[model samples]
Target: MPVAVGPYGQAQPSCFDRVKMGFMMGFAVGMAAGAMFGTFSCLRIGMRGRELMGGVGKTMMQSGGTFGTFMAIGMGIRC
Candidate 1:
């Protein structure tokens, strides 16, 4: 009688797999950083609940402005 082997295989990742992995890693890192900074800023400002939410909103608005400027610059460069 022949012994059966456990299922095991290795394969190289394709470009699509690489892109998927990269996106997942980036999303996880961004979430972690956002949580840390949001909490820290709120604590530093002595905010709670609604106040913390407001602080987050303000930060998001500021981030939007910065992101917009950078995106515009990148677009200009590409054009």
Candidate 2:
């Protein structure tokens, strides 16, 4: 007979871990949205590759930071 082991040797994640994961997911989504918006705005203003890439990167970081902060606050309030 062989013993069975759970995947990754873990059954479930802790509450804090789950909350962190959720915050990261939210940040990722926000970053994507920011990038899309930045790209479109830059294109509308006739920006080329380098400028467009720079705008997208800046927007993504800003949005991700905002999202993560709000997520942490909301989680704190809930807990």
Candidate 3:
């Protein structure tokens, strides 16, 4: 997204754009958090090998989706 000169050079982004940006940012953060939490939880539960990978992956996806949805809604509000 490029900014323009003064006086309405660049128009406001659409709702979809805002939501997309928010979702992406949230997903990045969520995945990091999920990875840490999932890794620890699985290890604490004595999970290993494929089971640990699956658990971490599942947790990451769920957290990413949850965060993305909330961030999208929050950004889309635009007020």
Candidate 4:
């Protein structure tokens, strides 16, 4: 097969590499979703600006932990 090269002259990634890349992209997206969920949940419960800001870190940590666990499980099954 002819190897495709980019501007940096790196050869094209293999199928597994592509899959890993996709998984990382998905992981980032999940983290963003988790952050949004945390923010919205705090707001919906009537938290004010300062309270909301204070809770954001904790909420994001919890959300990220949960999401990371799920992702790990999924990747374990697939890989």
Instruction: State the lDDT of candidate 4 residue by residue for 7-77, as single tens digits.
Output: 99988776666556555655666667767887898889989888988776677666666666666556556
Model 4 gets an lDDT of 0.70
| Candidate closest to the true structure, highest TM-score | 3
Which candidate should be chosen as best, given lDDT against the real structure? 3
Error of 2 at 48 (Å): 0.5
Runs with alpha carbons beyond 4 Å of true place in candidate 2 = 1-19
Give me the overall lDDT of model 2: 0.77
lDDT of each: 0.59, 0.77, 0.87, 0.70
Candidate 3's displacement at residue 20, Å, is 1.0
TM-score of 1: 0.48
Q: Candidate 1: misplaced stretches above 4 Å?
A: 1-36
Kindly list the per-residue Cα lDDT of model 1 for residues 13-70, writing each as its tens digit. 5545555555455545545555567778898979998989877766655554554445
lDDT of 2 by residue, 1-79 (tens): 3444578775565557656876887788779888888788888999898888998899898888778767766765665
Q: How large an RMSD does model 2 have? A: 6.5
Q: Could you tally the backbone clashes for each prediction? A: 0, 0, 0, 0
Q: What is the lDDT of candidate 1?
A: 0.59
Residue 75 C-alpha lDDT in model 1: 45
TM-scores across all candidates?
0.48, 0.70, 0.83, 0.52
- The predictions' CA RMSDs to the true structure, in order, are 11.3, 6.5, 3.9, 5.3
